[model samples]
Structure formats: structure tokens, C-alpha cells
Target: MYYLSSDLFFPSVSEANWDGVLAIGGDLSLERLQLSYKSGIFPWFEEGEPIMWWSPNPRMVLFLDELIVSKSMRNILNRNIFTVTFNQNFRDVISNCQNIERDGQNGTWITNEMIEAYCKLHELGIAKSVEVWQDKVLVGGLYGIDLGHVFCGESMFSIVSNASKVAFIALVNQLKKEDYKLLDCQVYNPHLESLGCREIDRTDFMEMLKGK
Candidate 1:
């Protein structure tokens, strides 16, 4: 794998190995993080491991127009059971995502260092968050990098059933209203697939980013 230092640079995405690991050991400085996402790369590694940058071959993305809102989800939205807000409590949203337990995971990938880095990005308006509240108490939310026409979703959490899904649907509708081009789901997973996120060649994703 390629190794990175303090230099503000990244190798071509084509240089990524079959597993999609492009480099290791880069610090998550604001400039680096900005460059990373703009270049269609992202950092993902455990707390004890050096930062790993990835550009997967088949990127998972959601076209704003293609968002799937199931009948149940639409009903939930219509009921107005939860309150959704954007960029209101980003720190809490991300903290919940970091602390929430999920199936098949021993520990969270959102380490303290990662949290601090992304929080800084949030302060700069580069990162955004969505909060879901019930009875005026935070129950679910999601966060990501906001790249104008493309939103790079990083993580989401829900305490009540379908809370996160509600937040997601609200965000999609808002993005569609604003004429966003895509929502970068990063990688494929059953949860995202069920939400109308699908895999597209990295080339195609890159082309869309270019148009951004």
C-alpha cells in the first residue's frame, strides 16, 4: 500500500488495490480531508491502525431522484411522528453514531481522533448533520460531508424504530428540493441497498463528481 506523510497529495484512484486501500498514515487535517472527499477518496481505519484511504471500484451512491421511500416510511413521514433538523446538533448526532451498538461490530470505527477531525470540518460548514427527535429528545440522526452537489454520508444512528430512516428520507427530500446530484453512501450494505442506494463504477462516480 502507498504510505502518506504531511504532504497535501493523494495518489490516483486507479492505484488503489483490489481491496480499495489507497494509502496509509496520513493525518486527518482539514485540508487533507477536504482533498480526500473532493478526490473521491475517504479515510477508514481502526483506532490503533494508521489512517487508511480508500477508493472502492464499485462505489455505493444514491441518486436524489431515485430515493426509495417505502409505503411504511411515507406513512411515518406523513404522520409527523418525529422532528428532523439539519446541522442543529452535529456533535451529538456524530457522538450517537459513534457510541450506538450495531450487529456484527465489536467496536466503533469513529475513534476520538476521527470524531475531532470531522467535528472540526462541521464547524467549517464542510460537514453536516441531521437530527431526529421524539418528545423533544434526540433519538436518531446522521452526518456527512457536504460537497455542494454531492453529499458523502459517513454514519447514522437510531434509538427508536425507523428513526434513522425518517431522518434519511427527510434529507433526501431536502436534497432533491435543492437539486443535489448524488448522495455518496460510500460502500454497499444491505441497509443502504434497501434505501435505493446502488453500486456504480468508480469511473461513473468520478464523472459525476467532476460535474459537481
Candidate 2:
């Protein structure tokens, strides 16, 4: 494992380590976070662990124009029963996603330090969130760091059935309106694939990042 230097450039990230994990044990400073997002790498690690950076091979991303709204989902979208908003309640959104009971993670990786770091990023306009609300309650949402033209999704959760999907749909639509190019889901999973996420080589992904 390479020891991280604060002065390293994006090009130093090893292509062979397409897992996107180039270095670790760095502080979550705004500069580091900014550089990471700009290069398509973000931090992901639990408390008591060194800060782990990841850039996975076959990057999973959801193109705004390609969001797959299924027949049932289309009907849900048409109903417009849920209220969708952006950056309105970021802490609430993050807290909701941190709910281990809903996330199914035995323990939460969103430690206090991580929360404060991202919250600081949000304050600086580098991180953003989309929230899904029903009956004035926050049931689902998603959060991530946003760089030039890409939003790297960190985590999402749903308290009510399909609520997280609703939040994702709102996020994609908003990105489309803003002319954003890509929504990075970071790692691939069945749930994301069902919603139109596809994998691309990290090399290709970083090339696309340069264009953005």
C-alpha cells in the first residue's frame, strides 16, 4: 500500500488498483476531499480504521438520461405523492442513511468524524443530498460529494418501502436539469443495476472525469 502524500496529483492514483483505493491514513481535509472527488475517489472506512480511499474497477454509474423507471415506478412517479427536495435537510438525510436497522449494516460506517467532515463539505457546497419526505417525515434520502460535473454517491437509505428509490429518482432528475454528466454509485449492486446503473472501467471513468 502506498503511503499518501498531501501533494500527490490525481495521475498518481494507480490504474492497476482500479478498486480505486490508492492510499489511506490521510486526514479528511477539504482540500483532500475536493481532490478525491475531482479524481473519482472518495473515503470509506469505519471508526478506529485508517481512512480508506477507493476507486473501484468497472465503476458503477447511473447516467441521468438513462434512469430506468419501471412500469410500477412510473405509476409512482406519476402519482407525485412524495415530496422531493435537495440540500434542504442534509443532517436529517445523513442520519436517516446512518440508521443501521434500515441500512442492514451490522454497524454504521458513518462515524461522528465522517458525519462532521461531510457536513463541513456540505457547508462549503462540495457535498449535497436529496431527500424524500412523506407526511412531513423524512423516510428516505441519499448523500454524496459533488465535483465539477459528477456527483459521487456515498450512501442512501429508505425507511419506508421504495422511499430510497424515490430519492434517487429525484436526484437524477435534478442532475439532468443541471446538465450534470454522471452520477457515480461508487460500487455496483443489484439494487442500483435495477435502477439503470452500469459498470465502466475505472480508466474510462477517470477519462470521462477529465472531460467533465
Candidate 3:
């Protein structure tokens, strides 16, 4: 893989290996992170590993028009049990995402450095959060980079059943109202697949990022 330096550049996404890792050793500066997402590349590595950038061949994404709300989710939405808001309590949202336990993961990728970097991005209005509140309690939420037409979802967490799902559905509805195009999910997971996210050719995904 290509090794990054202080010049603020990345190798072409086409150079990514079979596993989609394109480069390593880049600092997660705001400029680098913004440029990475704009180019359809993103950082995803373990806590102690060097910063690794990837541009997978089959990119998982959700086109706003294609978002699925199953009958169960529809019922939950009708109940209006959760209050959703945008860019509200971003730190809390990200912190929850960092601490919430997952099914198979032993640790979190949202390290302290990552959190500080993204929080800086948030201050610059380039990063955003979707908060799900239950009777004034921050029960669930998600955070991501807002790249104009696309929202590059980073992480989400739920303290109660379907809380994150409620936040996601609310986000979809808001994006639809604002005429946003795609939600970059990064990789395929059954959870996202159930929410109507699907993998498309990397070329297609890149083109979408360019508003093509």
C-alpha cells in the first residue's frame, strides 16, 4: 500500500488492493479527511494500527429514494416515541457510538484521536450528528461527514431497541426533504442491508460522489 506523507495527498482509488486498502500512515487532519471523503476514500483501522485509507470495489450506499422502512419500523415511526434532531449534541452522539457495545466487536474504531478530529470537523460545519432522544434522554444517535449531496455515515449507537433505526429513518426523511442524493455506508453489513443500503460498483459510487 502507498504510504502517505505531509503533502496531503492520496493514491488513486483504483490502486486499492483486493481488500480495498489504498494507503497508510496519513494523519487524520481535517483537510485530509475532507479530501478523502470527496474522493470516495475513507479511514478505517483498529486503535493501534496506522491510519488506513480504503476505497472498496463494491461500495455500500443508500440512495435516498431507495430507503426501506419495513412494517415494523413503520409501526415504530407511527408511535412517535423518539424525538430526532440534527447536529445536536454531537459530542454525546459520537461518544455513545464509541462506548456502545456491538455484537462481535471487542473494541471501538472511534478512538480519542478520531473523535477529536471529527469534533473539529463538526465545529467547521463539515461533520454532523443525528440525535435520538427519549423523554429528554439521549438514548441513541449517529454521526457522519456531510459532503453536500452525500452523507458519509461513520458510526451509530442505540441504548434501546430500535433507537438507532429511528434516528436513521428520521435522517432519511430529512435528507429526502433537502433533496440529498446518497448516503455512503462504506461497507456492507446485514444491518444496513435491512435498511435498504446496497453495494454498487466503486466506479458508480465515485461518479455519484462527483454528482454525476
Candidate 4:
């Protein structure tokens, strides 16, 4: 580990670690947060932990065209039981994502500082959110940074079954309409795989980030 700056300009980061912890200890000011995501980095740490940055190797990403809606999911979409919208109720979305308790996780990584930081970013238009509503109740949503045509998805939550997936589908559809190059999922999981997210080398991913 190298000495990370309290100020945001990342220290010389190492690709080997793939942790991509360029800097730490800085408040997630809009400028720093925007700059970090522009360079394919993001913050993830517990409330008491010094803000940890990450850019994992073999980053997980989903192409809009690759999304695989299953038969059941397709049926759900066809029924249109839920309504999807963009940038609606961002605060609520983040709040739910932060407050929702997950199995196995001792506590939320979405610290108060993180929440305020992202809220600030949302106001600046660099960060965006996708919301899912069922009969006017906010059920699911996600938020992330938008660097030119790439969307680095930060986090998502579902209050109801398939709600998160519905929100993700809307996000992908919107990104496709907007001509985004990629939807960076950061890390891989079985759920993301089922949604068509795949791993790509960090170098290549960065190259794609730069190319766009």
C-alpha cells in the first residue's frame, strides 16, 4: 500500500493490486467524486473506515444489447406492472439503498458521508439515478456516475422482488438510447451474470473508457 492523499488527486496507482485505491481520507466533494469516477475509480468503505477507493481488475460490465430478460422477466416486462423513470426521487433511492439491510453484511457501506457526497453529485448532473415505482410507491432504484458515454453503476436495491431488475432494465434501455459505451458494474456476481454482465481486463476496460 502506498501513501494516499487526503486531497483527491490519486497517488500513483498500481494495476497489480486492482484495488485501485488511488487516494483516501478526502471528503467526497463533488469535484473529487466526479474526477474519481471520470478516471474509473469509486469509493467503498465502512462508516468508520478511511474512505477506500477501488477499480477492480477484470471489471464487470453490461452491454445494453446483451441484456437477457428471462421468460418470466420478459412476461413481467410485458405486463408493465411497474413504472420506470430516470432521476426521479434520487434521495429516496439512495436512502433506501443505504438503509436496506442485506444478508451477511454487518452494516451498510453507504455511510452518511457517502450518501451526502452522492447526493451532491446527483445535483451536479454527473451522477444519475433510475427508479422503479409500483402504484406510486418507490420500490427499487440505483445510482452511478456518468463519464461521457460510460455509466459506472454504484449500487442498487429492491424493496420488492424483481424491482431492482426492472430498474436496471430501464437504466440499460435509457443508456442505449443515450448511446453509452458501457455500463460498468465494477465487480461480478451471479445476479449480474444473469443480467448479462461480463468480466473484462482492466486495461481493456480503461482503454474503452478512454476511447469514448
Candidate 5:
């Protein structure tokens, strides 16, 4: 229930309520966004609503060693039917994520303002994207903040079945090779669980964010 100002500061994650909503009404400026992510806070508000920041307890995360690639996914990866690239077309990847329709959702959280803000972060190498290409067509991708040892995944979209999955798998493999510690999924979903993402106490997650 805290309110933010132009100071680019956030209350401690411990101050978050039961729903994880830590505060409301903040600009998505680069400084504010960077400070928020570094502190394990992120904005997720629907259009027409003031920006809402959250740092949910029981944070959902995926450790590289714990990734679960299903047989079908393995077959797909083995087939080599898709090409994955990083930071090659972040703007497109994020635009697709903004437009792709999702079940049980009427509109996108990736608003025009959000897109511009994240793109700024990407240009500064603090944000990144994973793109899935099939026959030279961009079919699926995802984007998130890269906090050195931890990657905070924001959103993903797929135009074809399993396309997003393909992108996600590629991302995990790349992070593993790069020796990243964890992938912060923010919240839980069945799809991510099937991919081996599990929830840990938010305090533990914050410690990991600090490279502890």
C-alpha cells in the first residue's frame, strides 16, 4: 500500500502484502526499473491502472540443473527444426509478446509504454530476448531482465504450438552454458512447473539475487 515518488526508491520486499503488491504509482523510467529489478521488485499492472509493483513470496524460480525437458521437447530440439538467437531481434520479440493473445486475458500487460521502457533496458544490455525462428519466420520468443547471476523472465509468446517452449529451452541451455545461477519466473504456473520451476521463499530468492 506504499506510494512511490520520483526518488526511484522502493520499500523493502518484506513490506509486500499477502498478494505481493508492494506499491503503486511509479514511472517506468530506466532508473526506477533498474532499481526495482535489482531489488527483486517488478511492475505488473493492466492498462488504465497505475503501475503496480510486486515481490511475491514463494517466488517461482528455475535452477539450470533442475530443468525438465520432456521427451517431446527433446525430440523437437534434436530435430533441429528451429533456430534460436539472442538479442538479435528484441524489439520484434517483445512486440509479438505484446500482441499474442492469451487465454483468460482480455488485454496485454506489455503496454506501449512498457515496451519502450524495456527496449531502453535492452539497449543498455540489462535486458535480453530469446527468439525462435522456423524457416526464417519469427514464431516464438521471450524477454527479461538479466541481473548477472539471475535472469528475471518477464513474458513470452508463441504463434505456433510449443514455439515458446522451444525458445525457453534454448534460453535455459544458454544460461547453463554461461553459468547463470537461476531463472526468476516471478510467479507460479503449471506450464513452468512442468519445466521444473519451483517456488522458494522470497527471502531465499532475494539472497540468491545478491549472489549469496
Candidate 6:
């Protein structure tokens, strides 16, 4: 993988390896993060590891019009079982994502450093959050980078069953209403696929990211 220097720069995403590691050892400063997402790249590394940047070949994304809501989920959404809000509790949402346990994962990639950095992005209005609450208690939420037409999803957490799904659907509907382009899921996973996220060529994603 390419190594980053202190100077504000990044190798082209096309230089990434087969595994999609474009570079390593960069600090997560606000400027770098902003440029990274805009270039269709993102940082993902566990604690103690140098910040690793990636731009996967088969990048996973969800077109707003393509979000899938099952009958059970649609019924729950129709019932309004949870209240969804935007940018209400960003730190809480990201913190929960860092702490929540997930199957097949021994630890979270969302490190303390990342939390502080993204929280700063939130302050600058480049990052946004969606919060899901039930009976006035926070149970599910998500956070991501907002590129106007594209949203780069960072992480999400759900304490109650299907709470995350509720938050996701709300985000999709809101983005649809705003005429957003797509949700960048970064990588492929079963959960994201179940929700209608699919892979596209990195070049195609870049074109879309450019609003082409």
C-alpha cells in the first residue's frame, strides 16, 4: 500500500491494490477526510493500526430509488413505531457504533481518534446523522459524510431489533425527497445487500460521485 506524508496529498484511487488499500498512515484531519470522500475514498482501520484508505473496485452503494423495505419493515414504518431525527445526536450515534458488538467482529474499526475527527466534521456540517428513538429513548442511529448528491455511510448501531432498519428507511426516504443521488455503502455485506445495496464498478461510482 502507498504511504501518506504530512503534506496534503493522496495517490489516485486507481493505484489501490486488489484489496482496495490505496494508502496508509495518514492523519484524519478535516481537510483530508473531506478530500478523501470527494475522491471516492474512505479510511477504515482498527485501533492501533495506521489509518488505511480504500476505494474498492466493486464499491457497494444504494441508489435512493432502489432501497428495499420488506413487508414487516414497511408495516413497522407505517405504524411509526420509532421517531427519526437528523443531526440531533451525532456523537451519540457514532459512539454507539463504536461500542456496539457485531457478529464475527472482535472489535470495532471506529476508533477514538476517528470519533473525534468525525465529530469535528459534524461541527463543520460536512457530516450528518440520523437518530432513531422509541418511547423517547435513543435506540438506533447512523452517521455519514454528506456530499450533497452522495452520502458516504460511516457506521450505524441498533440496540432494539429492527431499529437500525427503521433509521435506514427514514434516511432513504428523506434523501429521496431531497433528490439525492445515492448512498455510498463503501463495501459489500449481507446486511447491506438485504437492504438493496449492490456493487458497481469503481469507475462508475466515480462518475456518479462527480454528478455525471
lDDT of 4: 0.84
For model 6, how many clashes?
0
Better of 3 and 5 by lDDT: 5
Tens-digit lDDT track for model 5 on 48-141?
8999999999999999999999999899889999899999999999999989988989989888999999999999999999999999999999
Off by over 4 Å in 4: 12-22
Model 6 per-residue lDDT tens digits across residues 1-212: 78899988888899999999999987999999999999999999999888999999999999988889999988888888899999999999999999999999999999999999999999999999999999999999999999999999988899999999888888999899999999999999999999999999999999999999
* RMSD, every candidate, angstroms: 0.8, 1.9, 0.8, 1.6, 0.7, 0.7
Compared with the true structure, the alpha-carbon lDDT of candidate 2 equals 0.82
State the local distance difference test value for candidate 5: 0.94
List the candidate numbers ranked by lDDT, top first: 5, 6, 1, 3, 4, 2
TM-score of each: 0.98, 0.92, 0.98, 0.94, 0.99, 0.98
Model 3 worst lDDT run, 10 consecutive residues: 169-178
lDDT by residue for model 3 (106-210), tens? 999888999999999999999999999999999998999998889999999999999999989888888888889999999999999999999999999988899
Alpha-carbon deviation at 85 in model 5, angstroms: 0.7
- TM-score, candidate number 5: 0.99
User: Which pairs clash (backbone N, Cα, C closer than 3 Å) in model 5?
Assistant: none
Q: Which runs of model 3 end up more than 4 angstroms from their true locations?
A: none
lDDT of each: 0.93, 0.82, 0.93, 0.84, 0.94, 0.94
Stretches > 4 Å off in candidate 2 = 5-11, 15-19, 102-104
On residues 1-212, what C-alpha lDDT tens digit does candidate 4 reach at each position?
Answer: 44456555764335427455555566677877877777777888898888777777878999779998899999999998999989978889999999988887987999888888888888888778999999999999999888868999989999999999999988898889989889999998899999999998877788888864
How far residue 24's Cα lies from its native spot in candidate 6, in Å, is 0.7
